[model samples]
Target: MEAAAPPRESRPGRDWDRITAIAAVLIGLAAVLVSVYTVLLQREQVRAEVWPRLDFYYAGVDGEFRVSNKGIGPAIIETVEVSIDGVPVRDWAEVTARLGLSDPGQLYSSLWGAVLSPGEHLAYLIPSGQEAFAQIRAETQRISMTVCYCSALRDCWLAAPEDDGQVEVDACPVLPPERRFQN
Candidate 1:
């Protein structure tokens, strides 16, 4: 048999090289995951900062029907819908006429395209006298209002008298001219 060759020398640090490469890859992957999670958390924090809430209130004693922005952010009113006995009315004037309160001496504010800052309120309808207040309060059972508003970030919600609370919406519906509330 030929003389045995001198024992071949094992390469130094061969195993350590593979281990180091795998560790580097794992570390990079972990960093990427952490960065993605951080981005998602920041996005959520931004949304919460500008979130808005709109609420409807009626003060029979004060003869006022108001809409308030109860959240920390401003509410941009998109649409207002008022109905009497399930029939849509174009304005507070029509509502008074339907209620048989001719010349109710109402002071009203337009709701369409209004912007209410945090804690701000708009008295959409205020009757001038006690008699009108009593009549309006009594007939409130037959009236309903639905309002749609958006936050500064464009997140929208629908506030309805019949709903338990406001409902989130992708966007506000576009009402026909006849169905649109002028006030």
Candidate 2:
């Protein structure tokens, strides 16, 4: 019939459908990126919380001992008590692992030692040429050292001995490298 006059030509472009599909894809991608960013931030925060603050190193020589403190804060290595292989000394302290600051050409003559500041270092010198009560072999003997240091940030604690009397450290970072004599 003449009234059917051609149903209005169906709209030519599917623009609305295309636009809706594009928006949906963009929203999904945005959600995925946001989730990934959140996960990475959380991982970084966890790693920063668990790191230890101090670094301890040691070295041995025929008569002197070198103890290094590679820590962020100033450290006081008070009274390094040395017992070889867990055998406590019965008489006069048989071991002499002393600490001191050293220069490029010579060692400081101060009899006692104290705080090692950041980047600044010191060393422990065991008086040279003395017959040790026990044969001090690098592989067989160890230095069980206890250091009492107060952190610049106001925390004080005693460090436990790393090696329970087994070997000696020839170079301690707390002291200058020139002062270090590797054994």
Top candidate when judged by TM-score against the true structure = 1
Worst 10 residues of 2 by lDDT: 99-108
Per-residue C-alpha lDDT of model 1 across residues 122-147, encoded as one tens digit per residue:
98888887778778878988888889
| Residue clash pairs of candidate 1 | none
Against the unseen true structure, what C-alpha lDDT does each candidate score? 0.87, 0.43
Off by over 4 Å in 1: 1-15, 162-164
- lDDT assessment of candidate 2: 0.43
Q: RMSDs, each prediction?
A: 4.6, 13.3
> Which one wins on lDDT?
1
Question: Candidate 1: lDDT over CA atoms?
Answer: 0.87
Off by over 4 Å in 2: 1-64, 85-93, 96-113, 126-142, 160-183
